[model samples]
Target: MAVVNEGALKKMLKQYKYKDLTVREITNVISQYKDLKPVMDAYVFNDGSSRDLMSLTGTVPVSYRGGLENCL
Candidate 1:
């Protein structure tokens, strides 16, 4: 899993609270941080799959701690 800097992201979001931001805009900000770029690039989004949904079951399962790190 990618270790993102939550503090930095929260600060950025707070700054844009009054503005309407698109997903691409937010994604651009995320990609600006070197640490998260690799993880972001590793996945595909908006495909015709339940993985893009907001619910936990709809997204990719977190199996890193269950001896499936390599599979992810």
Candidate 2:
């Protein structure tokens, strides 16, 4: 895992934009945010394609048409 400073992590969370983050990248950020566990565990994907940037900050995504809307 690449070592990222707290500032970088915080900035990512603050201005969340959809990006292709690897599983390790997601885990690194989640390790810093305790409340993000549910979001982390509830979703799974290859290529981290289903990850929602907002969910990293504990923001739950609203379902659209009875399905979770993935950022990708």
lDDT of each: 0.36, 0.48
- Kindly give the stretch of ten consecutive residues in candidate 2 with the minimal lDDT sum: 33-42
Q: Write the per-residue lDDT of candidate 2 for residues 1-72, one digit (tens) a residue.
A: 324355544455543543335444676665654345423223557767564443444543447999965332
| C-alpha lDDT (0 to 100) for residue 66 of candidate 2 | 92
Clash count, predicted structure 1:
0
Cα-based lDDT at residue 19, candidate 2: 34
TM-scores for candidates 1 onward, in order: 0.23, 0.26
Q: Lowest summed lDDT over 10 consecutive residues: which window, candidate 1?
A: 51-60
lDDT of 2 at 3: 43
Residue-level lDDT tens digits of model 1 in 1-72:
334454444444443443234334444544543233312212245784433211111122345756533222
Q: What RMSD value applies to candidate 1?
A: 10.9
lDDT of 1: 0.36
